[model samples]
Structure formats: C-alpha cells, structure tokens
Target: MLAVLEKVSFLLKMKVAQGFQTQIAGFYIYLGLMPSWSTRGL
Candidate 1:
C-alpha cells in the first residue's frame, strides 16, 4: 500500500514536471516564432 502511494506521488510529480517543461518550451517557441509580436505586446 505504501509503495503504491509512493508510485502515484512520483507519477504525479513527473507529470507536473512534464507540464512545466512543455509550457516553458511553448513560451520559447512562441517567442521564436514571433519575437516582434511578443516584444510589442510586452
């Protein structure tokens, strides 16, 4: 039971990390694709 709980927590952490990475990557991609637009908006 403890092991299963640990595994679930670990998977959740991994998913959160993956989500953060993807969001950061998407932000970079957006900047790369439209630097001027981003700059202007910012």
Candidate 2:
C-alpha cells in the first residue's frame, strides 16, 4: 500500500514538472514573437 502511494506521488510530481516546463516554453514562444508583433504594429 505504501509503495502504491509513493508511486502515485511520484507520478504527480512528474506531471507538475511537465506542466511547468510547458508553461515556460509557452512564455518563451510569446517572448520570441513579441518583437515581430511590435514592429508590425508600427
């Protein structure tokens, strides 16, 4: 029972990490596009 609980917790941690990574990637993509958007607006 304890092992199963541990495994579940580990999987949860991994999912959280993956989510954080995706958010960071999205932020970087937004940052990369900002300059082009600004230039186009002008």
Candidate 3:
C-alpha cells in the first residue's frame, strides 16, 4: 500500500512537471511566433 501511494505521488509530480514544461514551451512558441505575425500584419 505504501509503495502504491509512493508511485502515485511520483507520477503526479512528474505530470505536474511535464505540464509546467509544456506551458513554458508554449509560451516561448507564442512569443517566438508573435513577432512574425505582427510583421505580417504590418
């Protein structure tokens, strides 16, 4: 039971970390893309 709980906790932490990384990557992509979009708009 303890092992299972530990596994669940580890997986949850991994998922949260993955989510944060994905958000940061997405933010950078948006930042990277926006300049081109604005340039096109002009």
Candidate 4:
C-alpha cells in the first residue's frame, strides 16, 4: 500500500511540474509576441 501511494504521489507531482512548465513557456511566448502584435495593432 505504501509503495502504491508513493507511485501515485510521484505521478501527480510530475504532472503538476509539467503543467507549470507549459504555463511558463506559454507566458514567455505571449510576452515575446506582444511587441509584434502591438505593432500590427492586434
């Protein structure tokens, strides 16, 4: 039971980390595109 719980926790942590990384990447991409968007009046 302990081993199963640990495995589940690890998987959950990995998923959370991946989601955080994706969010960070998206934020940077948005920031990088902002200048061009403003220039184009979008």
Candidate 5:
C-alpha cells in the first residue's frame, strides 16, 4: 500500500513537472485519503 502511494505521488509529481496546475490539489486529495489521521494519536 505504501508503495502504491509512492507510485501515485510520483505520477502526480510528473504531471506537476509538466506544468499541470493540479499539484497541490492532488496533494490535498492524497492527504485526505491517507489513513494516518485515523491511526495516529494526536
């Protein structure tokens, strides 16, 4: 699963490098989908 996230992040980075404006959008979406918030002790 972590590998998958890394792959997705890499792809997103590639798109951003190509001048896509969705970089931060994709990052926030990724953050929202990540499970760390539920598992971590705040």
Candidate 6:
C-alpha cells in the first residue's frame, strides 16, 4: 500500500515537472519571436 502511494506521488511530481518545463519552453519561444516582431514594426 505504501509503495503504491509513493509511486503515485512520484508520478504526480513528474507530471508537474513536465508541465513546468513546457511552460518554460513556451516562454522561451515567445521571447525568441519578440525581436523579429519588433523589427518588423519599425
């Protein structure tokens, strides 16, 4: 029973980490796009 609980918690942590990484990647992509957008505006 305890082992199962531990596994579940580990899975939850992994999911959270994955979500956090995806957000970070998206943020970086947005940052990468911003410079081109600004230059085009000028």
Pick the lDDT winner: 1
Off by over 4 Å in 5: 20-42
lDDT of 1 by residue, 1-42 (tens): 999999999999999999999999998888888868667888
Model 2, 39: alpha-carbon shift in Å? 12
lDDT of 1: 0.93
Shift in Å, residue 42, candidate 3: 19
Candidate 5 global TM-score: 0.44
Number of the candidate with higher TM-score, 1 or 6: 6
Work out how many backbone clashes candidate 6 has.
0
Kindly provide the TM-score of model 3 when superposed on the true structure, using C-alpha atoms.
Answer: 0.76
**Candidate with the greatest TM-score versus the true structure:** 4
Question: Which 10 consecutive positions of candidate 3 have the poorest summed lDDT?
Answer: 33-42
CA shift at 16, candidate 1, in angstroms? 0.6
25 Cα displacement, candidate 4 (Å) = 0.2
Task: Note the Cα lDDT for every prediction shown.
Answer: 0.93, 0.92, 0.91, 0.91, 0.79, 0.91
lDDT of 6 at 14: 100
| Model 2 per-residue lDDT tens digits across residues 1-42 | 999999999999999999999999998898787888685776
Q: Which residue runs does candidate 1 get wrong by more than 4 Å?
A: 36-42
- The TM-score of candidate 4 is 0.82
Tens digit of per-residue lDDT, candidate 5, span 1-42:
999999999999887776655777787787778799664653
Off-target runs (Cα >4 Å) in candidate 3 are 36-42
Q: Summarize candidate 4's per-residue lDDT along 1-42 as a digit string, tens digits.
A: 999999999999999999999999998898787887585774
Q: What is the TM-score of each candidate against the true structure?
A: 0.77, 0.81, 0.76, 0.82, 0.44, 0.82
Candidate 3 structure quality by residue, lDDT tens digits, 11-38: 9999999999999999889878787868
Residue 27 in candidate 5, Cα distance off native in Å = 26
In candidate 4, position 12 carries an lDDT of: 100
